[model samples]
Target: MSPWVADIEAAVDSVLQAYHRPGLPGVSVGVLAQGEVRLRKGYGLADIAGRRPNAPDVPMRIASLSKQFLVTVVLMLEAEGALSIDDDVHRYLPDLPDYGTPVTLRDLMSNQSGVRDFLELRLLCGGNFSDPATADESYALVKSASRLNFRPGTAFAYSNSGFMLLTLIVERLEGRSLESVLQSRLLSPLGMTQTHLARSDIPWLAQRAVPYVVENGCAARGEWSIPLDGAGGMISSIDDLLKWARYVADPASPHAAHFRRMARARPYADGTDSPYGLGFTVMPYRGLDSFGHHGQLPGVFAEIAWFPQIDAALVLLANTTEINPFHLGRRLADALFPAALAPRFPPEVVPPGHYYDPGENRVLRVLRQPDGENYLDSAMTRAPVEWHQAGRFRPYWPMLHLQLAAQDDALVGHDGPRAVAYRRLPTGYAGAPERFTGTFYLPGLESLWRISLHDGQLTLALTGRFGTRHFHLTPLTDEVLIATPAQAPDGHYRPTLRITGAHGQRRLMITTDRTSRLVAGEMLPSTDR
Candidate 1:
């Protein structure tokens, strides 16, 4: 190995050293450079009970990283004159509820379909990931939606429901199971012998790594019973991923054109380019153009990034949720190409306050940590801000960058491809939570929710198939409240409830990171209350 290659391996060790010990579930990392496997190593244990150390060939659930493969299959079918990315999705799945606009395959690929994410819907229905669900149940959950989050192609919102629908379309067109189609078209062709679409109800491979969730320093096995589909359900090892990466990075590969097409950004309705392309996130990291996607499930966290400037690809697959693959991937990239990284300067400090976006009825809080670090706070996440210049900043998350400049007493900027303007709210602005107290019905999912006030605190209760779940509602403004589950199943599922209209005609709009505009109308006073 050359000096640089040695340095990279050492960097990987340093980054993953904490998980290198025994008796803990860990990760498998693969690094490919110039069409060669520079490093393929596994750290920690794959099966703590069996004392099996993780290896490069230990199959693990990759979650949404399966999307790239699904997109590839769609492209292959398109090449065969079976479908077109620009064609309306209803052409293939005509039974789908019409949203009064054409939702094309391109919209689904770029996450602009405005479809509600089925996973979030399941959570909203009081169903956890561990709950047993069949493919039909999953499909029914998505198909029951009466409206789209927004007009198709107008904005971007990540939706697994779109991909699930794509899976149906692919199956309908090919007249075969998605597993069989993927195996015959992509996995088999690339010699990815150990990679295949996993089924939730079947027995796991003996060599597969056991997924674990660490709570209070204790590790427990994670369980998932939702059926596998094209949205996310692939299992593979580092070796197999490396082989796939080599093929993707090869300019002379037969699917080179398709890969390039997938990497190109697709524009929203306003003609502004989106950060996501076909099943891939297109962004620049350290001044290097990159494309990749991250995946997360109950206990799995995975990231696959490809930097064309350095002709390198990095894949990190973890069986435990304790580690963030993006952070590790950034550290590994820094070690491999330190000289290639662009220098970053501290961002110009803005007055810490709550900035509200009127269009989306959302608020962004600029908060200062005790350590003097600044963070951008939202309902579902708190990401540290790393400023690139005076007004431009990039958060410590993928596919997100922003520039906030003061304009007409407002913070005007763009969040990725979406233009946004936020006005600082008056300090101590609190909404009247009592005004929203009542039972509401969502006809889309046939779900009912009750907003109640008890001891000066508001709670939103949702009753569904599993049971009832109560979420603590914290007022953000006179019209918006952040509903946080009293005991979040995954500890990260929160949605914002925005109240609109006048006193007697008020409606609720629920939104999450991956879902938006789930409207619920107030039900008439009845005995059900």
Candidate 2:
């Protein structure tokens, strides 16, 4: 190992050590500088039961990182004059309903198309990822969507449907498989021998790591699957990722101008700049402009980040769902270029103390870390405070703001212009919980999520694409109910529910924003079971 790489190696080792435990799935990391692999290493057990060790060269599912390849192909086709990003999607998929306005390819590429995420859409339709649904089936499911979450170009929403459509478009234009197009256009050109778009034909990939999930300190296979299409597809090794990320960082290379655009931010009709462009997220890490993509799927985790200013790229791939490699890349960057990163941190930070917001019934706990750093705790989540300016802190949730001044007796919490006061008080809520009893049917899901009023206790019994689950609702308001799960194995993350529709029709809707958007359903007879 060279002296230049030792620091990065140590930094990566620290991250690996944090995640590496006995019977845990493993990780692989690759660092690239100037088109060469500077460092590559793997840790933990790739297959704990099989006694196989993970290596940096092993390809794992890259998930959403595959979107970059779709974006690249689209840009390539555009450069070839075959199509334009501004072309309406309906032009390609003519049967696609034109909902008031045109949805352009650019909107899809930049995630301003407002397409409901395909995975979320599947669950919304009571479809399971583990089910063997073809790409055409997936397309039909997306096509059947009655309305987009929002109009294209007006808002930015992360979507998998847009990319799936793009992959289909790519295959349609080239009249060949997606794998073939990717190979001839990008992978072969970059000498990325270990990378491939996830394909069923190549089931037994060489040096491939078996995906695993950890539960109770033991490795186990997870019951999760995603279509190996444009959205959450592609299996790649760190070496291949390094080559690809390095390629993306170079604006003077193939599809150079488009590559530059991929790293830049575009705005919506509202003029709010979107942090995402093409397939990569454009953000500041330690005050340095960075372009990267984070991918997570059941039993698979990966992060690919390119620091264009430093002319370096970092790739982290893992076989487990538990680890997050996103910040490890930043750590490596900081370690390699300490002098470049030191100025980003504040010289001094505030001490641990309590800040209160009694109106909303929450207290802000500023707690000290083991390292003496202070963090903001809001009962539910603890987060490191990012100082946007002196005495001002941005809340992890965009809706809230915390500002403190050393001058006066109390630190004030502000919600916009209003001076919202905080106090320490025990809060409780009781509402009309029994009103929500009877079978509600979602046509999209084709299943009834029956809420039964069993002896004054409210319970929800529902069937998913894969299995059945139960929940008990805690009433928050007359129209709001919190559905807490009884038992687990469900990867679903629905937390809240709201009941409405008194005026026109008695309808049931999910008021809480979940990953999946289930259409409001009509109430069916109790005998409909």
Q: Judged by TM-score, which candidate is best?
A: 1
Locate the minimum summed-lDDT window of 10 residues in model 1. 394-403
Clashing pairs in 2: 357-422, 358-422, 358-423
Every candidate's CA RMSD? 2.7, 5.8
Whole-model lDDT per candidate? 0.80, 0.66
TM-score of each: 0.92, 0.81
Candidate 1 structure lDDT: 0.80
For candidate 2, write residues 448-475 as lDDT tens digits.
6778887778988776453456777766
Write down the lDDT that model 2 would get.
0.66
User: Per-residue CA lDDT of candidate 1, range 1-529, in tens?
Assistant: 3324456678888788788766888888998988989898989899999999888999899888899999999998999998999999889888777778898998888888887778777777767778678888777787877678788777777788888888989999999999999999899989999999986838768888899887766788888888878888999889999999999999999999999999988887788777788998887777778888888877788899999888989999998888656666777887777777787665666667777776766666788888887877665556676665566675555534455675555678886557789887777646566887877777767677888999989998897765678889877677877777887466466677787787546798876666666778877676345
TM value for model 1: 0.92
lDDT of 2 at 305: 80
Candidate 1 deviant stretches above 4 angstroms:
1-6, 350-355, 365-373, 388-390, 399-411, 423-435, 500-504, 527-529
